[model samples]
Target chain A: MNGKEFWIYLAILAGSTYLIRAIPFAAVQKKISNVYVRSFLYYIPYTVLSAMTFPAALYATGNVVSAAAGLGVGMVFAVMKKGLTVVALISCVTVFVTDLILKQGI
Target chain B: MKQFLRGVRNGVPIGLGYLSVSFTFGIMAVSAGFSWWQAVLISMTTLTSAGQLAGINIMTVPGQYAEMLISQLTINIRYSFMSVSLSQLTTAEFKGIKRWLLGFFMTDEIFAVAACQREVSTKFFAGLAVMPYIGWTLGTLAGSLLGNVLPESVMNALCIAIYGMFVAIVAPDAKESRSLLAVVAVSVGLSCLFYYTPILKELSSGLAISVCAVVAALLGAFLFPVKEEASHER
Candidate 1:
């Protein structure tokens, strides 16, 4: 798209995104006392993060075997309390190395 | 100065993480026939992964406004949950424009940073949001402009950036909470089931991931409940 069209598209996107984010704030500007809603909100982050991260990490490889290898190593490091950088590096390395070793019949 | 530096420090890893993933988005946009500026503009405005990806899909299938809206809403519907959770954390005095503005930039990383803070000041959260916001937008712009010059191999590798960011977010928390161990376990297990099971493998990647995550977390919470002390603050 040209510059004018690009700006227009950006405007549309920015407007929509802002609206999606703004609606929740608008709704809950007042205190929400519902026990069930509060409890549900409490677990939202873990659920959201888990949903967002797990599948990609496990199925990084199209096949289950490779994916399991990567996820297995990742979970081990994650359980060990390795920080983000380390867990990521270890997972990627594990996937890469496993693929390499399996390829080489080692 | 201290607070500003803290924001920057908190943002560095997020910034670094965004650089690679946003760069990939940049490349994807351009390769899909969008101009560099068009790609950059999307990044600048949306500053979201699912939104931007949906944008690309819309661009490819122009004239499908309804379809685009549905796709975008489905992907971003989760943000509402994040917003609700964060709304509770904000002080009563933080109502009005400030809350609205800060709420705009509430991505997962930004939320994690804010949630983990000892004091969730509006100013500090805004500062933190600003750092990553600027980094992500600029990174996308730069990547779009430069993607043509980069090799396919390098771009492929950069595809892993989002995974890196997830690692960073979960790693620190997993260290603090023994309960999180089950969270990780269930997620991996469910993810494996989805991938390996023939019937379920037909599901879309995004939906599959979302289902696995939510179910696994719920199950994990039940099986290995967080002790009262840790649950108190969380």
Candidate 2:
């Protein structure tokens, strides 16, 4: 917590983080050719995205109801292939309004 | 140059999302007693939400170097998997120094975008990474300097936008492929299971996410292996 400790801590954290990220690239120098390995890598994105999204999305906002509404709206737009910004804004607005409505009813 | 511009354009929303989230982080950092420069520096160096927050928590407690190291290692090790996966898609010439530089900005958003591409160009990845990086740093600076200027209502609402964007990224693919749908379901199911189950609920978020993703992805690979022609298909 002093200036010196802060810098040192940040360095360690950053250094480790950088190493963790960069090591994989250094190790996996060439493109993978194995069928199963290739398939696993290809599926990584979607699965990671899914794992990060659900339940978290429903709890991201202040209330479950508003977050769910926002998620539904966001998914609708996303499925329709709306732009990222559009989906983001609309979903936020949906949550905002839903929260407002829920607040007033209470 | 064109690819770079396209990356920046695609990065616009991610930058916006980072601006708000890091702004929140900045407020938290300031409250946690970090000076403006320190808060900005942390954001610049770490570029990860969970790791930096946990780091800040550890910093407050003091003398928990081991704890801090373990926290960061566990929280961020997923990036290694992402980088390895991305390396397979990147050009063979994208090695040495270029790989190190690219690795710096391989945040989840950037990786998601870059990995979706047919060809991962260094130029495009650079452009994609820069916007969010600047947004993250500047947002931290603004938050630390300005404090909580935004209305509470707005900030609360904005919390879900980034998640919305994530849904936006994956929904299309899940719709197109049954295998992808199965993977999504499995991941969500496992995540929920981890979250709700009494004992498993104690598991760290990083580990839970990694387990869910890896397990679901392996199942997907086995159940629905990409055809030779469609292996590289986005």
Candidate 3:
């Protein structure tokens, strides 16, 4: 796109993004007095993150084996209470290596 | 001075992480025919994995405005929750303009770090925010400019950074409670369902994953409610 078109496109994109982000703050500013709504809001992040991470780790490459390997390594490290950096390294390395070996028939 | 150093120290790992993931985003944007400046600009504004991913998807599909909006909205809806949760964590003095300014810097990594702190001055948090903000923006610029230099395998490896970040976030909480274990388990299970179920496969990946997480978390919470601590006598 040219400069004018690009700017227009970006403006719309930025506006939409800012709107979504600004909504909760806007709602709070309005002084919504609902305890149940507030409680639901508190749990949204944990649920959203879980949903994002879970499925991909499970069905990567259409095979349970690879997913299992990744999850296994991740869970073990997680259970051992390793730090985020450590668990991430172990899980990814495990999946990458296992995927390589499985693909190579080694 | 000390706060600035602490910001720098905390920011280094996150900055390194951003370099890897944002590089992939940069490369993807360039490959999709976005200009270097455009890619950099997008990174500067969004500074989010899901948002960037959605942006790429929208760019790829010509004239799909509705699809693009929904895609971006779904992916970013989590931020609303992050914002709400974090609102409580801020000090009473951080009302009005300061809250809005701090809101801009509210991100998953920043929130995780801030949540762990017992009590920190808003100035320290602001200082902390500046480093990652600059690092993420610069990382994207560098990545966009350096497009296609790295091999695909290396790029694939870099995608693991977010997962690493998640592991870091969940590890502390998981260690502390069995209930959190249920949350993780249910999340994994729900993810599997979305991946394997043929009908659900038609839904967008972002939506599928997000729905699974919300459902799993609600189910887990209901099944294993957190027990209240014993009340102390007045």
Candidate 4:
């Protein structure tokens, strides 16, 4: 919304995020006994990253084609276990090149 | 001093990683109508890419405070688990304001690095957290400010960097673990379903993502459970 609302929303988000991490650090003294919970937590990072990546990445570029190209190059780099910065730079550059090509119609 | 320096050194790569992603976030934030200062402030306050993006998405629609809270809570809930896991590794003597401060800065990258250690010190963790914090905030500042001057085409393409970062994070794990591969496929498939299906597509992106991630993760846990491993420090 407005300026006030934005700050308030940020505050709510920051406070909630703070509580999420702080409560565990403040309260959880021992390793979790629950294997199910541990396993679930273990998988959260991978699944969440994947969920965020797929469709969202497709839409991030100017068009789906360029985005797909970027994604392809990115996946290739990632599967090869390239560093994060290298993968990101190559993907973005690929998207830029693909976008230019698609626009020029050459 | 050495421990803190080691933490700082270890955090350098993470900080560099954050720089690129938060730069993309900066552009997203400005495009969504937030000022550069506001974008940087959000990064400074939250230090969470997913939660901040979700919050920004909620902001775009307006009048969805409850949705904002739920989205942030769900997206950030993983950090709670990470904190719990890291707590087991932290020194028992660490507590009070220091604990709170470190906890606030315990982001995904920080936790991943810190957790790998046999033991963690407050100084080391602080050093580890500060570099990334500065990197994230500065990157947002650079993005929000520089993004305004950049051409539309360049900015659009640059946005792919964030996505690339996410893929880089997950692809290695998926390649190594069949269970993680399944989890990635399930999450991606569910996300696509949510995006394409008429009724499911009605859900906000934040909610859709959380649902996909949670469901896929639960299924993965059931199908391929992680065997318990002995801890070096605990």
Candidate 5:
């Protein structure tokens, strides 16, 4: 908690995190030949993002209705192949507006 | 150089999204009595929102280094999986020190964006990592220094920014291929099952996500193995 101890703690924390990312990345060189492994790797991105997004996104804005409004808007733009900034900014705006509508009871 | 600039451009939105999240992190850390520099240091070094948040909770007065170690490892194990996936996307010579340096910044956003590339170059990956680091550190400094300048509702709204970007990355890919659609759907279904069911709900967020990703991807691999020509197709 003090200045001195903070450095050590940060080192341990950062060191642990760095190793997790570094080791696997360094280990897996040359192309993976196995079909199952290759396919699994290919699908990892989509699956991880999907799992992280759902349900969690629903609760992100603290209000389910507003969050869903944001998520729906984001999904619409994303499916349209809009850029990341466009989709994300639109979602934020949607959440803000939805929260206003809910609070004002309009 | 062009690739590097392109990476920087692609990183801009991610950096913007990070500003909100790290700002909240800054507010929380300062409110907890830690100084602003401490929060900035954590963001700079660890570069993981959930892991750093967990670290803060575990870092009591006495400092449970053992507990912090385990908790951080648990929360960030997915990065290991992500790194392995990314390794396949890099050039043959991208190894040794470069792996350690770049892997240090391999947050979910950077990984998603980098993976979208056919192959990641060192310059490009380094450039992609730059702004998020600046945004994360600067945002924390601002939040810690300024306190709650942003409205609560506005801060809450910004919460969706990262997730929106995630959908932006994955949805179009899913649209391109039914197998990917199945993977996303199955992952989401399993994720909800873990999130909602009483017993499974107790699983930590990181573990729950890993389980969903691996199981769904495994099923995808078995049922819909890609032909050799399309193995690297995304």
Candidate 6:
């Protein structure tokens, strides 16, 4: 892709993304007062994170086995109260080693 | 300045997590034949994983600009929900420019950390956004320049790093609160249902995530409504 058309498409991509994000900031300047609505809003970050994790995490590597291995290790570290970076690095390392060992046919 | 530094401290981990994820994106965009600078540009401007991934596909073919707009909108719509939630968390401190700037940079991990805070000051959010933005762009630079030299196993392993960060963020809280646990379970279940069922599986990832999140949140709000004093507020 090149020329004016390419940049135009790029603008479309960037502009739409920016608008989707920026509109809410521009629109919702006040805290919501309803208990149910507030609670739902409060719960969104967690639910969104959770929905993004499972099944997707299981498919993140060469195969579900290694991915699940990483997820299992991640769960252990998370349960141990490790911070975000630690859990992520540990999980990455686990998948790395598991994939390596599996590759070695041992 | 102290608060800004604290935000930076909190953001460093998110920045580190972003490196692996954006490294993957960098490798992908380069391997797909886009210029390294173009890959970096996409990362810098878009600041989204799923959306950028979709945009790469859209841009690969010439004259797919219509698809470009549609895919970006479909893939990134989740940010609207996140931003609305974040608006409630922000204090009166953020003004037009800061909020607009922050909106441009908002990503999943940044939202996770920022929304957890009792107050989100402009400087703090700015501090939090900086490293992830830098790491994202630099990681793309590295990946496009060096991804093939890196082993496939390592790349595959690194791909899981962001998901690991998600687990890290969500697990401890779920462990503490039964309501949160229920919400997580419901979301995971719906995610699987959407992933595996024939018709349901056809839903785009952005839409699927939004549906699962909204449904799970509804479960929590209706079943275990939080006290007004309980949720984060300034």
- Give one clash count per candidate, in the order shown: 1, 0, 4, 0, 0, 0
Tens-place lDDT digits, model 4, residues B71-93? 88867776776676677667866
Tens-place lDDT digits, model 1, residues A36-99: 4544444556655665666664544444465556556766776676655565556555666666
Least accurate 10 contiguous residues by lDDT in model 5 chain B: B54-63
Residue B99's lDDT within candidate 6 is 84
Tens digits of per-residue lDDT, candidate 6, B29-125, equal 9888788888888888888888888888878788887778887877787889899889988879885777887899778889998987888898888
**Candidate 6 Cα lDDT to native:** 0.86
Q: Native-contact fraction for each model?
A: 0.32, 0.77, 0.30, 0.79, 0.85, 0.86
Per residue, candidate 5 scores C-alpha lDDT tens digits across B1-234 of 998899899999899999999998999998877898898888888898888887777765556888888888887888988998888888766788898778898998999999898889888899999889888999898988898998999999899999999989998888888888988999999999999999999887987898999999999999998787675565
Q: Please estimate how well model 2 matches the true structure, expressed as its whole-model Cα lDDT.
A: 0.86
Best candidate per lDDT, number? 5
Q: What is the lDDT, from 0 to 100, of the residue B53 in candidate 1?
A: 76
Residues B1-234 of candidate 1: C-alpha lDDT, one tens digit per residue: 676567666776677668767877887898888888778778877888767876786767545556556666655665666677677767666677877777788787777656555445666676787667877887788778887566543443344434655655666576676667567667667776877799997765545655765676566556665443454474
What DockQ results do all the predictions give, each relative to the true complex?
0.33, 0.78, 0.34, 0.56, 0.81, 0.79
**Candidate 4 chain B, poorest ten consecutive residues by summed lDDT:** B225-234
RMSD of each candidate relative to the true structure: 4.1, 1.4, 4.5, 4.1, 1.3, 1.8
Interface RMSD per candidate: 3.9, 1.2, 4.0, 3.5, 1.2, 1.3
Tens-digit lDDT track for model 3 on B1-234? 786567556555466567776777777887887888998888777667667766765766556667666777776665666666555445555556666656666666776555544433567677767766776777677778887676654455445555555665665565666666567677767776777789967776666665765665566546654432200000
Off by over 4 Å in 1: A2-9, A30-36, A58-82, A85-106, B148-158, B171-229, B232-234
Clashing pairs in 5: none
TM-score, structure 4 vs. true: 0.77
Off by over 4 Å in 6: none
Checking candidate 4 for backbone clashes, the offending pairs are none
Preferred candidate (lDDT higher): 3 or 4: 4
lDDT of 6 by residue, A1-106 (tens): 4667657766888899999999888788877899998999889999999999878889888689899999899998998889888998999999999988888999
